[model samples]
Target: MKSETYKITNAVVEDIITETSNIKTFVLKPDKGLEFKTGQFVELAVKGLGEAPFTPSSDPGISEKIDMTIMKVGLVTDAMHNMKKGEILGIRGPYGQGYPIDDFKGKRVCVIGGGVGLAPLRSLLYELMHDLSRFEKVSLYYGAKTPKDIVYKNYVKKLQQEKELDLFLTVDQADDSWTGNVGVVTTILEDLNPENSIACVCGPPIMMKFSTLKLLEIGFKEEDIYLSMEKNMSCGVGKCGHCRIGNYYACKDGPVFTYAQIKNFDEIWD
Candidate 1:
């Protein structure tokens, strides 16, 4: 039988790594292992502080521990950043629909992420990396506000050196020491072949909008493009109506959706 969605499990913060000035990756070891798919999220909570949804940055193949990359954005996350290793927290999910990686076999995969949005995409990427033969090709296009804002710097550097995948990085502005591409994430989409390929995108509202437009402009089908919608979710389950997108509940029907699935929804670009 499946576990209850509302049942909270205790987890220990085994390690914490500062990814950027404002973002940190928390490595948590749950009392009971969390078996989650690539794009699913978990509801993490502290006793007094509130809970928020965050996708696991670690690979799903690693059941021993899961990594959550969080940005110090609001009250709950602020408290999370101040939290120390060995502290106990609550985890209540591996919720929502994940990426359809199984259907991607023998097809080229393109991933685009901006800033902390890379967190969820990282999980999918790791799963893809684990078995390169499952796909024809893989490409990653990432962008941040500045070099200092880049998360998972060291790991991304190693991915850049791997000959199996194509990695591209960009920033809105470049410092004196920076010499890489300086533009939006969509700039790299120019050279990618949309034929027999699928695109997965996650980022700020504006970024996701423009990225989707660019992908469509480059011949990718609406059904072939996947998007991670960052709707306001109070509950990981469908009980709360906070994450509703038109007739669908983001928490239940999706957090991961195809462009064809959500393209008709009002204010989707907003």
Candidate 2:
């Protein structure tokens, strides 16, 4: 694909569901449907302000529109919040290597996501749900700062009820109204028997670091554990060097990468 030549098709914003005070899910429809794999990401732009890479939170099957979970942590995201429905925006990509779903056929799958990290992970979970027969057992452990921080509340609930998959959740601090487990996401690592499971994880740098340790201690191979990374990616293509972590570009090489591929990079987990 060529760089800097993408068409500004349709950029209308659809539904805006506030997941939390700092997080919101934006639905966008491009001119043509986006055919993307589970772990791919796209670069969204607001003209002169800049562009940032975001993973699509919607399922791969539903391609007419894309869903992006944005956290209000930066200038561009703050501008995104003020955007109204039907407002035009610019989008490029469906980039990077995604999860190897075909290899997981009839194999156990484990997914761990924390905070806004659940955005990309949620899309994978949804894809697995649609093809339940392809995999043997599916398990998900999702965590957030508090009960209010959890995104896709009803969808997680539905996954628990309908699918045979084991769904676990945790929170940092609990209020009087809170009822789920109280701790970090790593707590759920104890429940998994990693004899034959492929795990994918996405979260803050600290969470990912500790989670990788726990997964390793429990017999999960480093190669079997995938981690999503983020640095400063200006251009989604390999032309820019901002997102480099050692020799790899977070935008081109991955937003999703196996732990084995990144263990040698000193600054990756920091």
Candidate 3:
């Protein structure tokens, strides 16, 4: 992979779409086009502060700007919350091979996303939802900490309206006012048939680990199960040693990878 660093001459904080308290969507435009794939991530830098790898939550085709729905969970991201509109930042490429959309053609695709991990998967969902005919069935299972924690609330609602697509939502624990499925994300996976379909999993380490296990038990092939490995990725171009999970570089080799690719790696979640 080559280095593709660009300055964010134009940046803006878009609407706080979901009232997920700690999570919000930021819409940013580059000085020039910063094209990338759905599963690939970019290195977001706040000058003199720090940088972190974040997946673009916008459609892969829309090169004008990118939307990153981030959760304020760490140092750099917390600093990001303090940033105002028009503040310039640093960004880089749409690296890595995304989901095998081509292979999924004419086949049902199942997407399971948990918490902030839903951001990257939303990019793929955006693209897939646009052209529903290209796919057989698009079933999405998204889980969050609570009902209010769900991101992309409007989009998920619209997806539910599409008869061709089935959207399953669950909350770990809900308030007295909320009524919906209550359990782990893996529990929702049981409601679907993994046979002859592609399964994509992204979430907190524990959620994804168990989700993968459940998918395999439901008959999804190991190679057919795609996982977006969440790790500390510094240099999005692979130079930084922060995202290394053995010989593999999460920034370069993944952020998105098949289970067959990294299942044997030691302490992958560590």
Candidate 4:
């Protein structure tokens, strides 16, 4: 029999890392170990403030503790940001389907993330890095509103030096300290070869839409491009229709799906 899906497990905030001005990464130690595939998300609940779905930003290989990188976007997340270490919270799920990393073996993989959307892609990145030989090439294209908004700043800098990975960074607007690429994330796509490659993308709806178009223009097949469709995912299960996109439920069927799987869905870009 399948395990209970609605049970909420208790977890304690172990540590917190500030990623950007408005984003923070919370380290939580669950009462019991939790193992989840990269790209899967969990519904994190603050006692009286309610809950919201967030993807784990830490390595999926480690279950002792999980990291959730969250932005203070709304009431639930605002409470999460203000939550102190040792405070208690509830966790449910590792919900929705994750990226098909296994299918990416022997092929080139390209990941593109904008702003906090990088949270889920970060998990997938670490999973792919764990098995470096599985793919011919691994490239990450990341963008933020400004240099200060970049998440995992130090780590992203380190990734640029790794011979096995190709890392590209961009900002919508440049600051005095910013000297790197200045443009949208999709601007870097011109340098990427879509041949024998699959792309995994997540970001604001506008960014995802343009990135998908760029990938297609450069030859990425619709079926090979995976998208994270995280809308109003209140319930991690499909019982609630809050996250519905056409016939599919973003929570149950996917928060991760190929462009082809949802291309026909009206208002997918919304």
Candidate 4 lDDT tens digits, 65-178:
999999998999988988899999899888888888889999999999999999989889999999889999999999999999999988898898899999899999999999
The lDDT per prediction is: 0.91, 0.86, 0.81, 0.91
Which residue pairs clash in candidate 4? Answer: none
Ranking, lDDT, top scorer first: 1, 4, 2, 3
Candidate 3 per-residue C-alpha lDDT over 35-74 given as tens digits, one digit per residue, 9 for 90 to 100: 8878888877887888777898889889887998888988
Candidate 3 least-lDDT 10 residues: 1-10
In terms of lDDT, model 3 sits at 0.81
Error of 3 at 59 (Å): 1.5
Q: What is the TM-score of each candidate against the true structure?
A: 0.97, 0.95, 0.92, 0.97
The stretch of ten residues in a row with the least summed lDDT in candidate 4 is 1-10
Provide the global lDDT of candidate 4 against the true structure.
0.91
lDDT of 2: 0.86
RMSD after Cα superposition, model 2: 1.5
Question: What lDDT does candidate 1 reach at residue 155?
Answer: 89
lDDT of 1 by residue, 22-112 (tens): 9999999999999999999989998787799999999999877999999999999999999999999899888899998998999999999
In model 1, pairs of residues that clash are none
User: Model 2 over residues 1-270: C-alpha lDDT tens digits?
Assistant: 554454444577877888899899999988778888989988888867867778899998988989999998888899998888888778888878888888778788999999999999989988998878888889999889999899988787797796478889899988888888999999877978887788989988899888999999999999999898877767767777788877788878887888898889889887
